[model samples]
Target chain A: MIYLDHNATTPVSPQVLQAMMPFFQERFGNASSFCRIGRIARTALEEARASVAACIHASPDEIVFTGSGTEADNLALRGVCRAFHGRKRHVVTSAIEHHAVLKTCEDLEEQGIAVTRLPVDCRGMVDPDQVKNSLTPHTVLISIMAANNETGVIQPIASISRIARSRGILFHTDAVQAFGKIPVSVDDLGIDLMTLSAHKIYGPKGIGALYVRKGSAMAPILTGGSHERGKRAGTENIAAIAGFAQAAELAEKHLAEEAVRLAALRDAFEKEVVQRIARARVNGRDAPRVPNTSSLSFASVDGESVLLHLDLKGICASTGSACATGSPEPSHVMRAMGLSPMDAQSTIRFSLGRDTSQGDLDFTVGVLADAISKLRHISSTA
Target chain B: MAKERGDRDDTGMSSAENEKAQPIQGPVLFYNDTVIDHFTNPRNVGEMEPGEANGYALVGDPACGDQMKLWIRVDSGRITDIRFKSFGCPGAIATSSMATCMARGKTLEEAAELTDDDVVRALGGIPEDKKHCSLLGIMALQKAIDDYLLGRMCAEEGDDLS
Candidate 1:
């Protein structure tokens, strides 16, 4: 019942739900159609675009809506890569990027484009110096995330973006986790291309947007009918798009206060965890991070087991490793930070949301203490 | 949904000692009722005192991230008592618990022959991904039996099982 996995996805807020309801019913006309109802749909779509663009300080015309954040990342990476296909193309990115960007980079490697994966430090930060050193004349794009989904560690995006800008390379950031937790201005951060997802920001799934700076040259990855200014092709999910814009507006309106409140709650939870449980440590504790996330590692215990025990107590959390689900791979972000396999698997992520409270954190820490000790006891003879 | 959120927020009871576990009213996700039952209230969750347990086995490695310590008190060539300590997820714990329950009184030969399939089947069925976890219990039990057989030979030569 205590939902602390906001980094995974957030429930659609009531206001966002309300905003989406009308589009799903009587007003379900295609935005591309030329009829009267279609004109209404087009107007609503443009308004939503403007709302999202305003939240991130980009022009509405620069935004192109996509199916999801993953698609947007693909659009940014592959669009540019495909445009410069058959050239001496290369990309620079960090090891701690989300799978959306990482896997896309991997796929690019298969297609003969070179990818330089920079490693993060123990604090889960990608150094700007490393980004600068990795760049070459062949490096056409540099993609780094604004914040990590697991550790919530904020990357030195502005510094890295500055490097890319000075070198005349396209810079892209997956801001799916960072959009609401931190201020994400495309111009201010010097991002030429960016990916944004709705589900992580308390909006409906299957709707996202990409910000392409004016004059940023890239080919359309999705080809067909002319939509999203011919950059992406598909009939838009009007309801989800409307919900996304409303969610972005909501996040902009309350960004400062909610960021402060969630950070307080997250820190209190972390402090209580370390005090009550032996060997309980926070991952990326020294890094500048987003406000709502806490990644904790309990030594000598497996994270999947702890997650199971917490689930029994009606507390929702996530583990870094997918071992329990038949995937033995621990988080690449954790591994890239030089944690032992066991340490990586022992990590858990707790992401706070609007509904989280001091009391909720108190109860969660209490449950966590129980789960940790029980698991440790199960492993150790006493 | 509202009621569940309210229950989580009823966290005003700040004292952990006073926090009574509200019985789970909803179906546990992924796992069936049987797996949930054994994991929630796992049986035989302890170690045998030294000199009392003749057979012991530890399966899985910490690097692999899941392990169990199982002990058996064999008598007259029949398993008289069994206990286990496990550091694993629900599937590992549940299947191990069920294995111990199934092996408590079985003869040494019968216990050693118990398969991972039997433990999994005993739990109704685990998820396809977690089906591999059942091997931890069955492997540990067979290893304990092997340890017992090895100890009897070494006991006549004056040695102890670690």
Candidate 2:
């Protein structure tokens, strides 16, 4: 099957799988133990941490491994809020954040914290000025995503981070969708905390990392063992961390070339689909988007039906966010982009990756065109 | 259009494929071309001025993010006209269209009783996941009828007042 849902998760790279195979058997020792096997595991884990840090231009001491991107986000948001308890309690974020951030903010709100969800423009972009304007004396942190998972619209993280710094407020970004596909340098972006997931970059699942800059105060969300420098407490996932490092290294090496190629394929797919289909709209067309993603809406066609039809044609794509799949509600990201409810429900997202080819793009455009035409015909008659 | 599975010939093709190819013979849980057509090309969309209509009502939940405004022209307590404006998915639009068709020329009491199941049946059947979309229209229709009755009662009271 041709997979166009790379934003959801990517297949594990061969090099990453190869690097991890040895740890599952030969070096299968607890990193906390005091044996030679344990020492080997500990060394491998620290090396992986360094590689992860290198990918994001962060120091090795700043990285904290977590179970998933969701866990990373939870740790970042909740940990910081708890650490700064009784001082400042207001948090600010964009309306188009992934549920990992949005829902975490909501949970914090239930605990009496004030959350200001800033809206986006028609192209799914949150202006840096809006972030500056929303700040208050009670505001403790500003969490925004580096790139939207659905529309691929890149936010002005560096500008927003600058605004936060000027106000003495901490800045965090959920970079799960941006880390491997785009260039992410924490220092350049002025980010205090960031989230990354392994599965999104062809690494193994159940492993992710949070970047907390040195001397940043953050309380632990999970407290058990003294792992991850007392920032995150749990037994280290040695094999997945090793695989994540290998994948991060490989992704960093080919990031530019793969981005250029995927951008070409994505442009071709969008152009062909728009030319062939009536009322086809590219969401976030006016914004600076990540090269590999495209979100399109076909008028009068239900997104779920389009997804099912595309799946029938052996093309795997998604309608709106993968996190909200199977729910009948339209995407919050599209809604925040000022799209009507019908327009939001009629949208689909196709995210290309390093392995996507010209032939795959051609097949996808042809199949999508046919499916839209068929669905439109059925709609017209009914 | 339910049929006994044992009576049908099964080749190597999967059951889902067979159901897609021949939709009339199986359980109507999945949609056929007829349902897709209504959902895609929904009918009687648009709106009438609120005060000019004999009855009208707007219904939706902001929490759910679905809303609809329905209007009906009543002549002697029978619906002489029906139209709807909905902000929702294709399923909701189709349900509104189907509700309009089902309510035209019916008495206010009859139209108010139109349930989501009735709307789904009129389209031959909607997918289980999308059944809620059909309910939005049903709720709107019921509210419109209630508005019509309340308006009539107010008019009678005005006559008493005068």
Candidate 3:
């Protein structure tokens, strides 16, 4: 099956699987122990940390491994908020952040911390000026995502960083969908804390990392024995961490070339969609976006129906449509982008990966032409 | 209309759709075979000509992302034919198709009594979250019956309603 839902998650690459196989079998030892086996585990863990750090231009000491991207986001928001309690009682973020950040901010609000959710534009980009305007004297953090998981619209991260840096507020970005698909440098963007998930970059699931800049006043969210230098607790996932390192290195190696390749494929695919289908349009067509995603909306057709038709034809894609993922509402990202509820439900997200080729996309466009034509014919609106 | 599968000549499904849906679909995800069959090969799947339909109704709100338009032709106080079109999910399409199948050839009084539960039960079962979708088609059919009754009264009163 052709997989165009890489934004949700990805399979572990063959290289990553091979690199992680040894740690699961012969090199199985807890990183905390200090004996010969443990020493080997510790060395491997640190090396993995260094590789993760190198991908984002951070030092090894600042890298703290977590269970998943959600954990890293929770760690950043809760850890920073809990550290500066009572003094800085407000946090600022965009409304279109992943639910990990959005829900954590909700919990922070429940604990009496004020949160200002900034609104994004119709293209799903959070205006840097609006973020600057939302900050109060008590605001201690500004968290925004580098790119949206649904629309793939890249936000104005460097500008937001300039604003947060001038205000002395710590900046955090959820880069789960941005890293490996695009260039993400902590120093280049001036990000204080960033979230990374290995699964999104073709590494194994259950491995994530948070980059905490040196001297950032962040307390540990998970409090236990001193793992991740007191930032996170629990025994390290050595095998997954090793796989994550290999994935990061591989992504960095092909980052530029794949970006060009995928952008060409996505653009050409969208061009054919406009030519062959009526009332079909790209959601973030004019916005600056990552190279691998296309959010297509077809008028007078349900996205779930299209997705099912594609699945039957051996093509795997996803949609923001309701009742498919058990959510009663369409995507919040679409709603925040000023899409009508009907338009929101009509959206289908196709995210390309390393394995996608022109032939696959060509076959997809042909099948898509048939699917949309059939559904529209069955619809009364047509 | 329930068990006479493959006998009706009006199922708008064609050979292309049958070939498209002929693959052995597993039940792990999405609907059962019955729902998928109706969705992929829906019966009475088109709309009626402008003046051919004596009764018509459109149900569901676009804000909810599920809508269905149904048309009915009545003859001598008996339902003769039914057709529908939907902008909805697989459950909406399948349930709409089944509702039309259940309504055709029944008397108007009998057709008006058709309920959402009957349509859903006939399909074995729909996913819990999608049970709401089954209501769209039945609601449309009931409203179409009302439209037919209303039009008959207007004609009887010598009021030429457009």
- DockQ of each candidate's interface versus the true one? 0.33, 0.11, 0.53
Per-residue error (Å), model 3, residue B158: 5.2
TM-score of each predicted structure versus truth: 0.90, 0.78, 0.91
lDDT (Cα, tens digit) per residue for candidate 2, span A96-183: 9999999999999999899999999998999999899999999989999999999999999999999999998999999999988889
The candidate scoring highest on lDDT is: 3
Task: Put down candidate 3 lDDT per residue, A1-382, tens digits, no spaces.
Answer: 9888889889999999998998887899999998888988999999999999999999999999999999999999999998996688999999888899999999999999999999888888898889988999999999999998888999999999999999999999999999998899999999999999999899999999999999999999888999999999999999999999999999999999999999999999999998998888888788999999999989888888888899989998888522236565778888898987877777899999999999999999999889989888899767
Candidate 3 backbone collisions, by pair: none
lDDT of each: 0.85, 0.84, 0.88
Which fraction of the native contacts appears in each prediction? 0.50, 0.07, 0.68
lDDT accuracy of residue B36 in candidate 2: 54
Q: Comparing candidate 2 with candidate 3, which one achieves the higher lDDT?
A: 3
Q: Per lDDT, what order, best first?
A: 3, 1, 2
* Docking verdict class for candidate 3: medium
Q: Which stretches of candidate 1 lie over 4 Å from their true place?
A: A321-326, A380-382, B1-29, B61-64, B154-162
- Which regions of candidate 3 are displaced past 4 Å? A321-324, B1-29, B61-63, B154-162
Candidate ranking under TM-score, highest first, comes to 3, 1, 2
- Which 10 consecutive positions of candidate 3 chain B have the poorest summed lDDT? B17-26
Q: In candidate 2, what fraction of native interface contacts survive? A: 0.07
